[model samples]
Target: MSAFPQPAQPSLFGDDGPLRDTREPVLMSLNPVYYDLIWAGEKTYEFRRRFLTGQSVRWYVYLTGPVGRLGAVIDLGPAVVDAPEQIAEIAERTRAGNGASVFEYVRDLDQAFAIPIQRVAEYPGMPLEQLRTELGGFHPPQGYTRLRNHPDLLSICEKVRADSVRREMTVPGH
Candidate 1:
């Protein structure tokens, strides 16, 4: 529930210059983002706010486990992307013996890890072939969870497409 759906500009918009990333399997999910003033000030006005507030704890409450804050492992294992402390919190919840909480937590993690990584990229750079491989067989189905959970795949895909542009920039045209 970010206050912003899409950033007003791309991460590379400012000529602070493109980051020199030549590594494959670049894990962009862990990258940090800037917060708007209100969000930065602890207003908790984003979609995730529902959990942070008492209104609804289920959103991220999986990290806390049932019966209120179980253990670290139970919560952390399910998290596709979270801090070490958060993972630890989940594990702790598992030890507390919350059957419902532990079950919910484990399910989410499996979903995250099983996610076809190809979805991490988009049209231009989205490792389409890679996705097909991970997804199994040719032509992945629409509404793939890999695409749903990892939206960054689109931006990464677009950025990767720029590679051909880079090559064309230097190579002599036919």
Candidate 2:
């Protein structure tokens, strides 16, 4: 598994009480949410390639906006994002208004669907600095489990994730 430089916070989902467990953040990544962020980029093709390489990233359940195609950064290496159509689809079927969004599904998906890792987040909009701040001194909460048990849960397929990102960040690119 590739560990990110920034420590990730456990995603929280609901108010304290019985309904709380269901509000956890769904752990997702480049493998699934990749294409959409690229589509929203000013340099879509270039961004797409970098993301495929590994530069952009999104934390487990942080809020990422794609207002009218204005994609926000979630995954920073190649930057990953969830698209509108993807969100709309879920909203339509579940009447949940955002079932297609990872944010939406995160709160409602059956526990069986918890792949990668799932954590209860305080909010989907938790900022990166905030996550770092909150998690900086956190000890695992009661009855909580972590997915880092098996190292093989993630494997970086190639050097692209970083190589591609550097290509774009250089002064020449601008």
Candidate 3:
């Protein structure tokens, strides 16, 4: 017998249909510093130069550089597109002392996107080396890549999502 018990498989469908029918899955690379803030729940909004609006998105967060791993999945609400200054105002309102740098990042842009973080699920992580080995070769995205475009990556994300679901179900008071 195996030393560890296998986790229960997550159901793909609910009463309506697939559980993830509403949100599109996408892989997004984040700086280790910013990822740390998100992990700590200090960062509530993710500011981007551009992103999909009017729809929810599930972000498979890949921490770049030394970490070089996909460590967490974040469920994001619809993007709030607005002027850079206005986006900065949101950062300042939500979390003090965060607006200045956020403004700096998007100052040159005509419009920016403020993606609200709804939930975060952390996993053990998949390193870059392992990902490259599994998918033949993997290139971390500069912006974002739709999971649908890459079947292998999509499968990996699905497994992570399933694992997260299982973990949540098993947790007390979930």
Candidate 4:
């Protein structure tokens, strides 16, 4: 028998109440081109304006395209909101994508925001079907969303956290 017991199936609601877990998860969909850049550690800043809440939070990066998959999780730093020119300068200095491109994208917006990322984990591609199963029916967010009230996602996060702890505890020579 396995040492780790199977995780219990997640219900629509938890024992405490309607899922009100504080740890928030944002599901972000990115085009494969940018996703590849970020995944390769070439791009450090995810530029945004409308979708960003200026909060330092963890994000689940999902690659959307012909190859749709949940590929990585990142601890995003607090959003740095500034003028378009400054934002472009930051992007040019620290990121892989073109600064002019980023400037053009956010020039019309009130303020441009840069969410710096530190990759905590890189997960093998989980297909949309599997993600739907894990998330209890998922929709690709056009911008960003806080999965604060999602019971299924919260449960999955618990399992993932537990598994991560186990992996970290395992002795290399054992």
Candidate 5:
């Protein structure tokens, strides 16, 4: 009776390619300003001081403050770890007006991560209050929390991802 396809049913991407099982998803808190950029497809890379390298990941975006909701999921490519200047170069090459800010953010660190945004899926989000009520007390992560560590949250994300895939499949020319 459920509208969304079950996870174990079949390949959402098609028969030849099953969904690539990336590393466990992470819940990341984002400032509303930057979250808007990401949602609008203006921001191509997410700069991080520390993050898992060598693996792709799905980031469950928790928009902080005025927008206190888990609003979107972003699929990210493997992180590009490099010197601050080098990372800044990537920002400049990809999107204009972000290079200086990116440089400033990573300047103090020896190395930084430039996580490429592969895809983004927006959905009707679970608000913070509702999440806390459902989870019996939830705090948005300051750094990041692996979804696997919280089965409840992981289950929610899985459903959302499945629905997103279904929508993509139904969309013409997807």
Candidate 6:
């Protein structure tokens, strides 16, 4: 038998049908510097070689250690795919100062894409241990994955989304 227990079925739907879940799972192996920059709203775009094409994917940040946990949900704009120089131009137009970093990350690659992101909600995050317990054996994705495909992770993300909504509703201004 497996050492870790499987997750229960996700209660992701209402009587009508599946709830519209816009959030997508993304495991970013980010350094603290980049993480802080993204959180601070200093960085507006995330560089990547590939992203889910022709899809509206809002990234759920799973910040790698030394702060291993689920951090925030960011709605991503369309992936702007082009050659390195072209991508840099787009970044400059968007006023993203991290354009140079994008070039660096895509140095060897002929083409790359940048996903513009705005933080929808930020949280302290679920620790790795807790994540492992919930997911039955969580390993950070080397690249990224769609959370909807992973029942266990999707369930946790759904809770996170619910909590975020609840917190917003309880707030005085919201």
Cα error, residue 111 of model 1, in Å, equals 14
Clash number for candidate 1? 26
Write one digit per residue (lDDT tens) for candidate 4, span 15-70. 34444443347767778787666656567778886655646676776778787776
lDDT (C-alpha) at residue 20 in model 5? 52
**Overall local distance difference test of candidate 3:** 0.82
Best by TM-score: 3
lDDT of 5 at 22: 49
Q: Candidates' TM-scores?
A: 0.17, 0.20, 0.81, 0.69, 0.78, 0.73
Top candidate by lDDT: 3
Error of 3 at 9 (Å): 20
Q: Please, what is the whole-model Cα lDDT of each candidate in the order they appear?
A: 0.25, 0.27, 0.82, 0.67, 0.79, 0.66
Q: C-alpha displacement of 18 in model 4, angstroms?
A: 26
What does candidate 1's lDDT look like per residue over 56-165, in tens digits? 11111101112221011001111133433343344344333333433344444422111111111111223335544543533322221132244554333334444432
What range of 10 consecutive residues in model 1 has the weakest lDDT sum?
Answer: 69-78
lDDT of 5 by residue, 51-100 (tens): 98898888988889998987678878889999999999988877797899
TM-score of 3: 0.81
Q: Compared to the true structure, candidate 6 yields what TM-score?
A: 0.73
- Where is model 5 more than 4 Å wrong at Cα? 1-20, 159-174
- Model 5 residue 58 CA deviation in Å: 0.8
lDDT of 3 by residue, 79-157 (tens): 8999999999988877799999899989999999998887777787789998888889999999989898888899977
Please identify which of the two predictions, 2 or 3, would achieve the higher TM-score against the true structure.
Answer: 3
How would the candidate models be sorted by TM-score, starting from the highest?
3, 5, 6, 4, 2, 1
Q: Which parts of model 6 are misplaced by more than 4 Å?
A: 1-29, 92-97, 165-174
**TM-score, cand. 2 vs. native:** 0.20
